[model samples]
Target: MGNAIELYDWNVYAIFAPFFAAQFFNLKHPVSALLATYAVFAVAFVMRPIGGFLFGWLADRHGRRMSMLLSVGLASAGSLLIGLAPTYSSVGLTASVVLVLARLIQGLAYGGEIASSHTYIAEVAPAPRRGLWSSIICISSMSALLVATLLGATLSTVLAKQQMVGWGWRVPFVVGGVLGIVALVLRRTLSETNAYEQARTERQTGSRPSMMRGIWQNRIAGLRVIGLVVGGTVFFYTWLVAAPAYAITVKHIPAPEALWSGVIATSVMIVVLPFAGALSDRIGRRPNFVFFTLAAAALSFPLNRLIQNKAWQLTLAMTIAGVTIALVVSILPAVLAELFPTHVRAAGIGVPYSLAVALCGGTAPLLQTWLATSGRGDLFIGYSVVLLLIGTVVVLAMPETKAKPLE
Candidate 1:
């Protein structure tokens, strides 16, 4: 439920990127307006690491349940603010300022929610079936994207363009806010993990300091997380969000067709996600990680070119990419959770993962746009390849986590 609510809030903004750009920027040039909107979107990701560190600390010192509740509360507030925000015509620069602020809060909440929730779920699950249980987090998030895409499509089809830009975009935000409240209520009933309880009971004094000391001692684990996540984040945001926008705006594909292509691809990913995790459980995590990273590196260019062909071709290409993405995303939670002791697992995952996300995922759209506009679309492909190569190297160097306990 928490995963669903988080993805709902995150994808709502992404699905309505075009509408927001037109409504908020007041620019005559469509690409310029979209770029401006994406810039603001990237700025929100800048706050993720801070939120990760802050709430991760809270989760370690206080409790995971409390940290999750706080994250949902902040997401709810941000969604409501976005729903009620005025357009540029009515409020000038203040409207944009408010929009960015809302996104910052949303991003921060998102940063904390996934890391803490993943840690909680991984800790609670049995050792052997941990991969299967952790896969549900990604499944829930992908399901939320499916909902967002369907809602966006329905609204886009029913409302006239003017109405969509002016008011229809608010519907998703309002729905997201309500869903966040529901998630908060559901999360309140969850029991704290035994890992946290055991850690607390075992320690006599200065536990917080001990946890910090442990994190500092295992610095290599954090670096491994950064290396593993960088390529995955870049691939995800570029292929899913930025590519769709590029297809519509630059390639002149029909908006509905492009969106439907993504919708179909995401649906395929949701189905395959758990299977990939199960495969990792059987075969081992390192092999799957190495395969997907290499596949992403080799396929990035061809996939981009295929998507530029026709609608059906684009859908086919996206489906393949989606499968690769699913394989990577499904096992990551379990792998990261096993990297640290129970004392600081939340921070261990959140801080470094958030940093990698900020450095790679956050800038994906802007970098893609710049590359496309500069007549260097191949450069974007190169960038993805380089990241994947780095990730594959790190994955090979790091120890496999399939046999490890959560703590």
Candidate 2:
């Protein structure tokens, strides 16, 4: 729940950005305002690597429980700040600055949450069932995403256009703030896992180096994490995060219909994630990633071609993309956590994973929008296919760890 709530805080901004972009930005045109908003969104993502390092070290050295507690508190505070922030009409440029600051805080919290939660979940699940258990991470994430989409659909349906742009845009941030507190309260009940306990014991015995040194030592594994993440993250943000906005703004779909299409596609993701994870358990981690990358590459062109101005077209494109996404993300936490020893698991995964996502996933939406506006949407599809193929190569090169015990 805590994990889910933080992600909601992270993503709710994207769903509502089109409504609020003009509020904070002083751009002349709506398109310019939207672009500026996404630039700020990208700026927040750039902070993820720094946050990942800070919190990942804390988790590795302190405890995952404590790191998580701190992260959620920060996330809630950020959400509240955004909810209460003044608009440009009242505060001028300060409003935009406030939004940036708040986004930075949430980015840090999100980076921390990813590191700690993935390590925690991977450590606690029984070895044989780790793949299946890891599905909970993305399940929680996608569930949060689904709620934000539904909320968007609901607000778009019931609220007048003026109402949405005026005050309705801020409602989700406030709701996320409240949810964060609830998640914090719930997370308090969680205990440290046996793996972390064991790792902590070893640390006291002087079995580990400084966090920086440890991360450096495992840099090769870190690079692999980047390679594995870059392609998948691009594919993910393109179809899932940016689809609705692209359809509404570019393809000229109705706002409510665009949002509803996201609701449907994300619902499909939530359902398939667990089954994909279980499949990885039955076969191997490599096969799921291999298949996902190859399938994503193979389908990118045709699926993109299917998208049109209609909501159904957008829904169909995204639904297909969602299924392919599940095959990689459902077992991704397990794969990432397994790459390093417990001593540096959180930091090792955090630094590189966040870096990859910040670079590739963060820019994906803006890049796609720019290309589409330039009459080069097909080029972006080709770009995605190339990235997925690269990811496939990386997956094939990496060792299969399905049956290996976590160090």
Candidate 3:
């Protein structure tokens, strides 16, 4: 539930970018305004590593529950601020500044939420079913994407352009704030993970140093976590956020149709994610990642070309892209969590993952836009392929964690 709320808030901004861009920036150039909005989106990612380290440390020293509760509270506050933000006409630069600040807080909360939640879930789940349980994190996130897309689509259908640009875009933020509170309520009932408790007890009785020192001692493991995350995060943002804008702006597709394509693609992803994760449990992470990445790299050109066709073709192409994303994202939480020891697990997972996200995922949309504008969309594909190949090599180098005990 917490993960769902986090993704919903995060994706709501992306899905509503066109509308919000017009609302907030009031720029004459549509692409420029959209880029500006995405720039703010990217800015929030800059804080992710900070959030990850701060909350990861809190989760390690204090408790996951406490960290989660605090993070959610911060996210809720940010959402409310966005819901209530004034337009540039009313507040000048203050509006954009406020929006960026609110997003920064949201990014920070989200950075910690995923790593801590996944770590907590992995610790509690039985070894054989760990993949299945861990996949729920993606399932919840995809579900949030589904909701955000649907809401964005519905609002576009029901509200006039002027109304949406005026106040309708704020509706999702208000709804997100309310749902964030509900997630907080649900989180209150969650028991502390036995793994965390055991780790805490051991620390109290043993001689473990700071999490930073422990991470330094396990630098190779930390690099492996970063390597595993790079492909998944880059592919995810590319297909989901970058593709829609690319379809609409560069390909000159209708806005409604482009959004519908995204909606269909996200729905397919939700269905396929759990199955892929389950497959990884049965087979192994390395093999699944290898197959998925190779297939994706091979198909990148064909898929992008197909998506530039008619609306139905676009939907089919996006569905295929979502399948490729599901293969990587569904298994990532479990794989990353399994790479570290319990003592520095939170910091180990959170910091490196956030770093990769900041470097790759957050910049994906902007980078793809620039590449396409420079008459080199294929370059973006090549970039994605290189990351996936790097990740494949790293995955092959690492040991499989299937059926391994969480601790």
Task: State which candidate has the highest lDDT.
Answer: 2
- Local distance difference test, per candidate? 0.85, 0.90, 0.83
> Candidate 3 regions off by >4 Å?
none
TM-scores, each model vs. reference: 0.97, 0.98, 0.97
Question: What stretches of model 2 exceed 4 Å from their correct place?
Answer: none
Best by TM-score: 2
Question: Residue 278 in model 3: shift from native, Å?
Answer: 1.3
Ordered list by lDDT, greatest first: 2, 1, 3
Worst 10 residues of 2 by lDDT: 398-407
lDDT of 2 by residue, 1-407 (tens): 99889988988888888889899988868778888888888999988898899999999988999999999989988988999999999999999999999999998988898899999999898777889999999999999999998999999999998999999988989999988889888889999988888888987887678888988899889999999999999999889887898787778888899999999999999999999999988899999999999999999999888887788999989999999899999998899988989989999989999999898888888888888988999888888888888888888899988856887
Q: TM-score for candidate 2, please give it.
A: 0.98
The worst-scoring run of ten residues by lDDT in candidate 1 lies at 202-211
Q: Model 3 residue 78 lDDT? A: 87
